[model samples]
Every structure is written in structure tokens, then in C-alpha cells.
Target: MQQLTVKEINTLVNGEVVGEYTGTITGLERIDKAGVGELTFIGNLKFSKKWDTSEASVAIVYEGIKIDPGAGKAFIKVKNPDLAMAQVLEVYLPDSPHFETDIHPTAVIDESARVGKGCRIGANTYVGKGVILGEGVTLYPNVSVFDHTSIGDHTTVWSGTVIRERSEIGKHCIFHANVSIGADGFGYRPSEQGLTKIPHIGHVVIGNHVEIGANSCVDRGKFSATVLGDGCKIDNLVQIGHNSVLGRFCIMAGNSGLAGSVTLGDGVVIGGSASIKDHTTIHSGATVGAGSGVMNDVGPGKTVVGYPACDSRDMLKQWVALRKLGKS
Candidate 1:
């Protein structure tokens, strides 16, 4: 454990120290929750009172924040404390954990497959026939890559992620534990006698810098590619249905589910547990708040929230009206 002084902390973060850098800060936390020997942060001016009462040894504050210097806490001022905190954690939680580049003794690699240079295939991991994995790829324990699947350079698939046959995933992507990509889409049709399954005949294409969170599922298309654009990020337990198109830098929060054929434009943000109905097109830069249910197409750069999600203004008005009615 590296015990960093206030001076060392400022050097590491390039932040201005309002008090003596002699006090030692052992670690970092949040302003509302940090204790002794730890450094925490206050994101905005509203939390100034909270900063005064926080028990942390040092507080990382954004510029233009004014608080009592004698509040028994040191101040570390930065242009962007959140970004600096991220860098601090990176230095603390370095990814130097041991991973042997050699194929594990128990790893199963197909004879016809091309496993690239400087790769690590963990125990019980299966690399199928005709799979072409690029350089610096890593498959954690129990990963299953099916036949003919192509994974690009510098990709990492965490434990228990299943990549189905023929799915093409781009470079620098992450599939967290228990993620299922290229699985058969949920396709069913009603018949006179009973329900019949629609055949899923297509693959999934995930672009670079995309991340699929733990327990999330991205289903394959019926006859074409179900795609996620570059730099898109999916949160844990998300369900992306078949043939859905997610644009660049889009974000889906935890437990959100998108139905089949949904098209999200660039930088679309959906909150936790939000459900977007099938085939809905959320335009570019739209933001959907947590637990929203979208049944229509959302216009670009608009913020939507609530069930059958409406525009943010309308939703707030409706909530206010509902509260008034409840009082009456």
C-alpha cells in the first residue's frame, strides 16, 4: 500500500493544494462516505456543506468551490476532479495481474484455428475451428468462441462469455462475464394451431471500443447483422434483442432491455431498467432516464423519461399534476 502525502497527491494529480501537503492521505473515497486517512471528492458547489462535515483527511474539489479551510480537511483543487479521480484509481488498480501468454494446459484450441501472437487462453476455454484471433487477445477461464468467429486485435473476453459461431467482433472491445453474443434471437410467430419459431440465420457485428456488461445478451439477426457501433457501452444485465442497431458512443444502463430491430442513433443514452419497444428509433444524442419505457421514436438530442416515455418536460408536468391529484 502506497501512503501518499498531500504533496505527493498534488504531484500525481497536478492539483492545487489549499493547505499543507504534509498530511498523509492513505486512500480515496466519495465525499459523503469517506473516513480518516482517505481523500474524497465534492463534484459541485451544492455539496460544500457536506465537504465541511466529511471526515476525510483531504477533499478533492472542483475549481470555484469555496469552503472553510479550517474544516479539519485539506483541499485538493483540480479542473476536473472526477477525471483526476479516474486517473488516480488507474494508478492504484493497475492491470498487472499475472496472465501467462502461453495457452493453458487445459485450453482447447482447434487445429485449424489461428491463435495470434502474445495471446493468453485460460483453462477450459474453447477456441473453435477456423477462428482467427488477432494479436494480444485474451480469453479468460471458460470462454467459448465458436467456429469461424473473428476477433480483432487487443480484445479481451472475460470469464464465461459465449461468442456464437461466425460473429465478427472488432478490436479493443470487452465482453464481461456471462455475456452471450450472437445467440438466436427471440423470434416467434402465431399460427392457427400453435406458435412457431422464426429461424435466426444471421450474425452479430460489434464494433471497436464497444463493451458488453456482465450477464448482458446481444442476439443475432434473423437474416442480417445485429450491430453495435464503435465506442458504444452497455451496462450490466442488459438485453439487446435481435437485429437491433446501436450507433456510436451510445449507452445503455443496467437492466435495460431493447426489443428486436430497435435502432439507436449516435450517443443515445438509456437509463437503468428502461425498456424500448421493438423497432423504435431513438435519434442521435437522445437521453432516456432510468426506468423509462419507450413506445415511440425519440427525436434527436431530446431527453425522455418515465413509462411510455414522453419528453422530459411533459413527464415532469405529468408527475406534478399526478402529485396534486393525489393530495386532492
Candidate 2:
């Protein structure tokens, strides 16, 4: 078990300790559940007010919040308590599996593939012809890199992930288990033969520091690449359609989906279960609330909610009216 003194923890987060105490914190837990020898955090004023109820020996709190730490307890005040807690958690993060910087005997690498120095190709993994893997890339067991794909340095592809032909992935990106990249887009047209499938010739382009959760799918484009910009984070079970372009630092929560050609500007946040229609453009910093079905463009920094999503304020007014009608 890892333990740190209150003074040591305060130094780690550059926090000012209030109500001096010299107790050791063994672990971290939720504020409500934290007990003696445990550390907790109060991110907001409400949580700060509730500090008295928490049995934690030490807590990280926002700098300006005034809260009384009971006898023998201490509060470490930092600029942002939530971020401070994350820093502390990073210290406690367990070690991940170590790749041996060598290819497994069961792995298959084509003669035309180019693998960089210090790469690790796991058991039963396949590196197709003309694939270029940069230095320090790690492909876990059962991963497939199709022909003509290029993955940048230090990228890690977990088990069961498939990167189709011509896909381009940048450095330091992480693809969780079972993620599917570059599958053909869902495009069909009515024809004499009932329906004709539109062949997808394009691929996927993922930028640096991007993380895609397990079971998420990024479909191939019709003519151009489906793009995920730098630092984008996608949650589990999400679907990104063909030719969709996500700007830098965009975040899509679990179960959210985008139809074909949807464009999201930088810092856009799509809540869990939200759905965006085809050809819609959401500008920078826009937020789509959970369960919203977006049908039109959303301006920068705006928040929209409800089915057939509208401005949050307008949706709130409509909801109030509907509630009054129900009462009447």
C-alpha cells in the first residue's frame, strides 16, 4: 500500500495545507466514502460545504473555498481540486503490461512491411504488406494492420483492433480493444437493381494523442478520409460515419454517433447517447446534451438539448410549458 504524509501530498500538488496535521494518507476514495487514512477532494463549493460530513483525514479543496476542517483533519487548497486529484491518482496508477520490444513468433509480418526500431508485435498479430509502423509502436495480440497503413511513433493498438488499408494514425494515440477503423461507409442508392452500394475508397486519418474506446467504429469515407483530429477522445460504443471531420480536442461520450459528413469544430462535446444528423456542422466549443438528436447547425460555445435539439434555454421553456399543460 502506498502512503504519503499530509506535508508530502501538499508538496506534490503545490497546495497550502490548512489545519496542520501529520497523518499519513493510505489511499484515495470518493468524498462520501472516504474514511481515516484516506484522501478525498472537494471540487465545488457544495462539496466543500459537505467536507464536515466526510471522514477523510485529508482533502484537496479549491483555493478560495472556506471550509472548516474538524480537529486533526487537514485541507489542501489548490487551484483546481479536481485536476489536483487527477495528478494524485496518476501517482497511484498501476503499471501496465510491458511489451518486450520484439515480435512474437506467432506474429506474421509481410515482406513489404516496414517496422521501426523498438516495436512490439504481439502473438497472432498480422502486419500486412506495405504497412509502416513507427518506432516504439505496440500492437497487442490479435491486432490487424491492413496493407498500406501507416502508424506513427509510440502508438498502441490493443487486442482485436483492425486498421484497414491506407489508414494513417499519428503518434502516441491509443486504440482500445475491438475498435474498428476504415470499414466501408453505410451508403446505398436506389437503382434498377433495387439498391446499389456505394463503394468506399477512402480511409481513416487519426491525429496524435487521440484515444478511441473499445467497440467504437470509424467508417471509411466515400472519396476523402474520415478524420479524427489531434487530442480527440471517443468513448465506448460510439459510431463515426464516413467523411466526418472532428476538430482538435473534441470529445464524444459513450453511445454518441455522427452521421455521414458531419463536421465538429474544436472543443465540441457530444454528450452520451446524442446523435447528429448527416451534413450538420457544430462549431467550436458547442455542446450537445445527452440524448439530443441534432438536426441542424449549432453555433460556437452554445449548448443544445432535447430531441430534435434546440437551444438549452428554449428547450427548458418548452419543457416547463409542457409540464404546466400536464398539470392543467
Candidate 3:
């Protein structure tokens, strides 16, 4: 990242400096681990202990937070510091251009397939029979699009990602490297003999603008569609199991695992390494904190954190009391 001055940050994000300060910040990071020349945030007062140790030149903080005067860190006060920081950071990204549209010679496109004009199929990609790919779809090297699958316009599927048969992917959806959509779920039936595999006949249906991260798996349903609603942002290594339905604009962080038949309402967010049980429902705007083990349904707009996932407020209170108990 290029160095940005304090004045440049204020201009980019429309923020004001709370204290008299001027310096060049090289990058953005969290307060607990920011290095020299990096600008970080102090959203939670709990992280105050790490402020003194932070090598950051400046910290973006909200009004009314008291830091140690000895720390000597310049502060940027805003109505919402985090949002301002994010806005300033957005300008540093590279622009994507539209130029080429052509399939590679090595790509094996089935004669029975129906592909839209101007689609680009990369090397070693296999578009199976009866597959319907909309216009401007770009498949990276080695992407396997199975039979009867339908992908909407302008979707980009990265290398090694496999779309199983009969899946329905929406427009502008990006499946990053090694993403596996509409794969068979782990379903078995107990019989008098041995375990019998239950065939998954249902598909995975994704809505528009949904972006799936690298190496993630969204399994095919047993009978009905496993749906990912519009604009759901899933992170790397996340797993959405069979028959699950995620609502619009849901955000799931890395390594979050949702069991089969689970349902998430709109704007739900599951933190990193969180595990949600099968058949449980998460209501709209709910948040599950990092490492949470959710066994029961979550209420709308509530924040849950901890093992067996209790309310975030109750968990924080218990954690504070427990620490004091240990000290006593």
C-alpha cells in the first residue's frame, strides 16, 4: 500500500482529526497488532490494554474514549471510525477492465451445450451436455461445469472449482479458486445390512451478486434446492451443507460451518470458525461471534457468542466475572 498522509485520509473519507496531527500511514490494521506507519482502530474499549504496545502512528477512535496520555498516539475522531477507515481503503484497489472474450482451444465444450455469445472458456475446462451458460461468463483453467447446470450472465468461476449437475448459479457470482458448488452431501441411511448412500437429486441455487470464497463447499440438497440468497458474501473454507437456505446479504467469515437443513435470514453474519447446528434457524440481522458453537435457533438481530452460543451480553458479563473470580 502506498503511504497516505493524515490530510489525504481526511479528504478521502471526509473525516476530521480530533487532535493536532500530521503523518503518513502506510496501511490499515487492527489496533492490537498494527505496526509502525500503520493506521489502526480502537473500536472496543477492551482493547485499550494493547494501545500502549501498538507501534501504530495513529489510531482512529470514536469520541469520548480515554487513552493513556503516555502512549503518544495521534487520534482521528469520527462519527464512525471503522466505516471511515473502510471508505478510505477502497480507493487503493486496482480497476478491472473489459477486453477479451474467447474460449481456449483446449476447452472441451459439449456440442449439446448452449453457451451465450462472448463467453470465455479457459484451458482444460469442461462444459457438459445440456449446460446453459449466459453471456460474458468467464471460466478459469480446469473449471468443471457439469451437465444440465445453468449459470447466469457475467459470472466468473475460478480454477479447479466444480459445479455439479443441475446446479443453478446466478449472475455476477464469483466462485473463487477451488470452490465446490452443488456437490453431493454426506447422507447415509441405516439398514439391516450396512450403510446405504442416499442419492442427492436436488440442486444448489445461488442468487445474484453472491460471492463464494476459495475452497468453500456448498452441498447439493437431498430433495429440494440448497439456496444461497442474493448478495451473500461467504469467506474462504466455509461450508454450507445440504438443504441449507441462507438469506440475502448474509456474511460468513472463514472456516464457518453450517450444518444441513439450517436456515439463515437476511443480513445474518457468522464469524470465523463458528459452527451452526443442523435444522436451526438464524433470524434476520443476527450475528454469531467468532468461535461460537450454535446449537439452537438465534433470534433476529441478536448477537450470540461462546460455546453452545449464549447471548453476547450474558457471555461478556460471565467472562468478566469469571476473570475476577480467578484473580480473587
Candidates' lDDT values, in order? Answer: 0.90, 0.94, 0.88
lDDT of 1: 0.90
Candidate number achieving the greatest lDDT relative to the actual structure: 2
Residue 104 CA error for candidate 1 (Å)? 0.6
- Against the true structure, what is each candidate's TM-score? 0.92, 0.93, 0.76
Instruction: State the lDDT of candidate 2 residue by residue for 99-185, as single tens digits.
Output: 664899999999999999999999999999999999999999999999999999999999999999999999999999999999999
RMSD of 1: 2.1
Please give the range of 10 consecutive residues that has the lowest summed lDDT in model 1: 92-101
Between prediction 1 and prediction 2, which has the larger TM-score? 2
**Model 2 pairs in collision:** none
lDDT of model number 3? 0.88
**Which stretches of candidate 3 lie above 4 Å from their native place?**
1-101
lDDT (Cα, 0-100) at 37 in candidate 1? 82
lDDT of 3 by residue, 1-328 (tens): 5678777777776666655445687778787678877888776678666788888877777666776424345777677877876776686554543424488888999999998987889889999999999998989889999999999999999999999999999999999999999999889899978899999989999999999999999999999999999999999999999999999999999999999999999999999999999999999999999999999999999999999899999999999999999999
**How many steric clashes between backbone atoms does each model show?**
0, 0, 0
Count of backbone collisions in candidate 2: 0
